[model samples]
Target chain A: MANDTLQPALPTPESPASSVSTPQAGWVPMVLIGIALTFLALILYIPAINVFYQAFHKGIGPFLHNLQEPNFQRAVWMTLTLAAIAVPVNTIFGLCTAWSLANKHFRGRTLLLSIIDLPFAISPVVAGLMIMLLYGRQGWFGNWLLDRDIRIVFGLPAMVLATAFVSMPFVAREVIPVLEEEGTDQEQAAYTLGATPWQTFWRVTVPNIRWGLLYGILLTNARAMGEFGAVAVVSGNIIGKTQSLPLFVEEAYRNYDTEAACSAAVLLALLAIVTLILKEILERRTGGHLRKRH
Target chain B: MTATDHLPRTGTAPWQVFWHSLIHLPWTWRVMLGYLTLMLLLPTAALFTKSLSIGPAEFWRIATSPIALSAYDVTFTTSLIAALIDGVFGVLIAWVLVRYQFPFQKIIDASIDLPFALPTAVAGLTLATVYSENGWIGALLAPFGIKVAFTRLGVGVAMMFISLPFVVRTVQPVLMQMERETEEAAWSLGASSWLTFWRVLLPPLLPAILTGVALGFSRAVGEFGSTVIISSNTPFKDLIAPVLVFQRLEQYDYAGATVIGTVMLLISLLMLLVINFIQAWGRRYG
Candidate 1:
């Protein structure tokens, strides 16, 4: 962290070292910073605090009642189940992809890296449309599956796919940087000592990247649980059968169930705050290795 | 270090050859390629295939239709405005985070990423509530004849909320890693502070700022959850492309939805490429 004094003129962006001995910055920079911080406080801080405040403003009884509603309950369960399935799958996908990406030499490697981030760069709605194009009743594979009386679109499978797609990049994005920064020396050393690749990975690689991996998984779980647009498109927003927590929030808000919507939003906001806390801890513990990219 | 730095430095070493062969195995390739192809590559390909089936003429017709064009206009213009606003404030916020310590600093820093971690729909709901006519911020501005919740302004607010973290995160790291001695050296050389910043500091920061701008822009463009809830969703007004795609899907116009989606995909991919390029450039220079 820097002192309020913006001393010694503007520093080059992206340097990690802090300067406590630098001269204090002029009042001009202080005024600018004051305005910026104030605006930020109004925008990001106020509304977030308001979510929790309003959720409980009327009383915990209303919040509890909203929580007990079957629709809300089902949405919570569906959200958790989606995360349960999506996180592990994407985590594995991320591990394999990161392992190959960080360790391998092959053509189209850059292409693969970009592809991994495709989910992040693409709109979630577009992601859902892509899935629907694949699995809808008249879709390429959908027609074939229809022949066998299968239902993917407007179902749990579709929701899972949508969630998985949106969260695909998290673990790999986090792990790749750490692995790249840490290098492959230990893996190579393990191989020379007659360790199998899997053994070497479990023993050397995983431990080295444990914090980064957990951070990535934490982020993946957050996104998986909170994904809205893609799931909304593919799940058809069916109240009980397909509604995830986010969809439920949207529905509850639209239907003027302000209590229910605010409560649900508060729950998700709490999850997000928890995610941020854990991330901050991991980042400090790891000395911010998780923030690097190459 | 470049990604290729991790590659075996000497190609002739036995260990290096063995490692290459292992990574080159069908199993490794399958695990990497298979998952992506199934989850990402194939589905995206299917989307393009579906969209292309409508042919260029029909695709052009739908993409350029009056309503679609209006939706595109709303989406792009508001996103650009939001990204621009974020560009300025994001740098300010990042600077404050890097250059100043304040009370609740950790809490504020942690909360910056609330947008990233929080559900977008939840953001939309909360934002709509707070900015609606009778709501807190809305009520304050209601006397001024400013309507936010159901207009393009609300859409921009939603986009800004979700995309703010992008600029702050991108620029903050660069600012943190900045060498203070460069500015000190310039000051020692008798250069004015403003001149030193303009001549020395601004050059390297530009690429990073551009990268942040591009990322925020793309994120805003692709935004759906919040905008869908905040905007009126009426075409030729605040309606955005993503909502239009959703609306088309709801109407069972799968082809129309796919076409709109395809347009979004192409534009986003282009923007992402630009962002990645600028980031790489920043890494190289900054």
Candidate 2:
């Protein structure tokens, strides 16, 4: 089954390179690739150029001034705070969930896995709405929480909860497959050596899955930093208080402050570029490890 | 290392111990299940209940209103077109990145993920600025009378931008895993390149491509950040279902918002179900 599937996809010496080199074959595929690249470039290139042009048109002075804007600074601070809190909490939750699912053969295991994956399939906006219904003033648990004066719908709590909710599945998704593939041998060996459960987990299991965990955390941080739909619904978009960078950008765009919005967007683009770079490095390292194991 | 380690001690009764430990743990699967049920299932149930209480008559009246119907039309049509475009181009890009070695291959591969990491609101603002008549590429496309900003086309472009990654990412791994020997064998046997691709390569890829297209479609339909920014959001023209839902919620018409949201949810659920069925069938047969 595996050979049957694998054979056709990879190129081999027996296949004449003539097919790809033929003028007719080359033209169609090349044009198709060209058109695809053109479309993609159209989407990314223009906006990138616009940001650079706007930033440099007034030179570094105004650009730096814009960055120093108090709202921009606060937005960045809040975004960092949100990511710092959400990524670690979700990573821990994901680790626990992964351990349970991987080690235990409980009834409803499949159901539990599916439920854990539910957040990935559901819309972020829906996630925010779900939390709101549970914790909003007019929601089912809202009155009870309101009596205690706990606010979760329009502030940092809501933001963190929403971010965490959407991001929980990432670490688990990465770690579970690795755990399954690596098996329980090392863990059992540690247990046999009189290691307690915590000791075995910390000393034996975690090191093997640390790379996957870091990958998941990287993805989670990126998502948390950029999340807009869920945050928008729950944030109330209060200028410096509730607004993150994305929300601030949206507000600026809505109010027709195009330059300021572009400036904030450049910051976001820079973040995205950094994330892409980090992901590439991680993926390359992981790929190298896998190849060496093979 | 052996089954003995997993077995119960002579009198310890492992199953009982497991049950006891499970019960004692504060954060067990049961608790997690309860939390998820409360957070996800219950609110969705509320949305459905709210929709149901409005009755079919009220639903028909509200959902079929000219403005609402127009919004639905724009949303689905734009999403469908965008998904179609993304599927084709996304497949090509994935194919190139996986199958070819070229200058800047690493750069292109990394750039393909740029859309995934970019914030939708940021993408929206950037695209709007760049595609406006006064913007960079707009200057070139303007002479051709192609206006991308503040139009339905602009909405489609934004949706395509955000969704392009879904298709490529979904398909690329499958492409990479496929072996080339079969194609070589076919070629040695005198099969044409097109024939080999059509008979061998395309079959396994169809399922993954379809899955990606479906994901892109659903994402485009639900998109709000970029669409709202780039498009005018004028009623009956550029407004999408999610945006309309937000507008209703902003107006404090909870019932109305829930109804609209429920309708969208139902449609998306149905679409996804169909796509999944196709995926299963493709995997089985293709």
- Quote the true-contact fraction of every model: 0.66, 0.37
Residue range B212-254, candidate 2, lDDT tens digits: 8888888888787788889988898788877887777677676
Cα lDDT tens digits, model 1, A1-294, are 444244544554333233322234456566866888777866787788779888999889999988899988999999999999999999988888788788666677787788788888899999999888889987888879998998999999999999999998999989988899889888889999999998998999999999999999999999999999999999989898899999999998899988889999999999998998998999899987777221
How big an interface RMSD has model 2? 6.4
Query: Number of clashing pairs, model 2?
Result: 8
lDDT of model number 1? 0.86
Give the local distance difference test score of model 2: 0.77
The lDDT per prediction is 0.86, 0.77
TM-score quality measure for candidate 2: 0.87
**Alpha-carbon deviation at A292 in model 2, angstroms:** 19
Using DockQ as the measure, which candidate wins? 1
